[model samples]
Target: MEMQGEERIAARRDIVWAALNDPEILRQCIPGCQSLELKSPTELSASVKIKIGPVSASFSGDVVLSNINAPESYTISGEGKGGIAGFAKGGADVILTEDGDDTILAYEAKAEIGGKLAQLGSRLVGSSAKKLAQQFFADFNAAVSAQAAANS
Candidate 1:
């Protein structure tokens, strides 16, 4: 599945960029995230538990940042294995554009799933994925804005 959207965060591009790279911020922003640990500057290990329709699973994966352009854009990709439930893999191209004191964050994302998840039907899986993505960005925007306010 594929999705794209943009959010106007009430913070500077640099602050937003830093928040994007911070594991603590990401851990809070990612829906269902149980834990997130930075393995390196460009890599992280994460565990997330999710429920789709009637299926629930815990996924452990490694997320990597690539095609990086500091404070501007990057591609974040990861794949997770959920035992028998299935596996999910995807990537997102994120771009940050400055607008006054705020930052415009845009992203184009694509995902693929196999096993029981794929058996759940495309409509169900697609809608759930969209909702999860929306939640993540909304949480991220709130976190960044709050952090910016606190710092200022």
Candidate 2:
């Protein structure tokens, strides 16, 4: 499946960039993220629990950030294993553009699943993925906005 969208954050591009790289911020924003640990400057190990249709599983994954351009853009890729449920892998290209004191964050992402997850039908999986993506961004925006306000 493929997903893409844009959001305007009430914070500077630099701040938004920092938040993107922050493990704590990401853990808080990710829909089902239980933990996000920075393994390296551009690598993270994460655990997340999610439910899709009738499957609920806890997945452990590694995320790597590459093709980075500071305060501008980067490519994030990750894959996870969910035991009997299935496995999933995806990548996203994120771009951040400055809009006055705010930042415009855009992303294009592609994901694939196999095993039992693939058996759930595309409609169910796609809708679930979209909802999770929306929830992540909504939470992320709120967290960033709250932090920006606190800092000012």
Candidate 3:
């Protein structure tokens, strides 16, 4: 599955970029994210609990950041295992740009799944993945917006 969207943030580009790279903000915005830890400046580990149709499982994943330009753009990729439920791996390319006093955040991502989740059906996996991605982005946008408003 692939997902793409844009968010208009009421903050400076540098602030938005910093928040994007902040482990705490990422953890708070990711849906079902139980925990997120930064392994290094360029790496992070996350644990998430996800439910799709009748399957639910906890997944632990590692993410690596590359193609990075501080306070601008980067590419992040990760994969996770969910025991009997299945497995998932994906990556996203994110860009942050300044628009006058605001920030524009855009992302394009692609993901794949296999095992029980895939065996059940691709449609279910795709739909659920899309929904989860949308929800996560919505939460992230709201989070940044709220923080910017508060600071302003």
**Per-prediction TM-score to the true structure, in the order listed:** 0.99, 0.98, 0.95
| Residue-wise C-alpha lDDT for candidate 2, range 1-152, written one tens digit per residue | 99999999999988999999999999999988999999999999999999999999899989999999998999999999999988999999999999899899999999999989999999999999999988988898899989999999
Ranking by TM-score: 1, 2, 3
lDDT of 1: 0.98
Which candidate has the highest lDDT of all? Answer: 1
Q: Arrange candidates by lDDT, highest first: which order?
A: 1, 2, 3
Clashes of 2: 0
Q: lDDT of each model, Cα atoms only?
A: 0.98, 0.94, 0.89
Q: List residue ranges in candidate 2 displaced over 4 A.
A: none
Model 2: which residue pairs collide?
none
How many residue pairs collide in each prediction?
A: 0, 0, 0
State the lDDT of candidate 1 residue by residue for 24-91, as single tens digits.
99999999999999999999999999999999999999999999999999999999999999999999
Write the residue-wise lDDT of candidate 3 on 23-56 in tens digits. Answer: 9999998989999999999999999998889888
| Residue 92 in candidate 3, Cα distance off native in Å | 0.3
List candidate 1 stretches off by more than 4 Å.
none
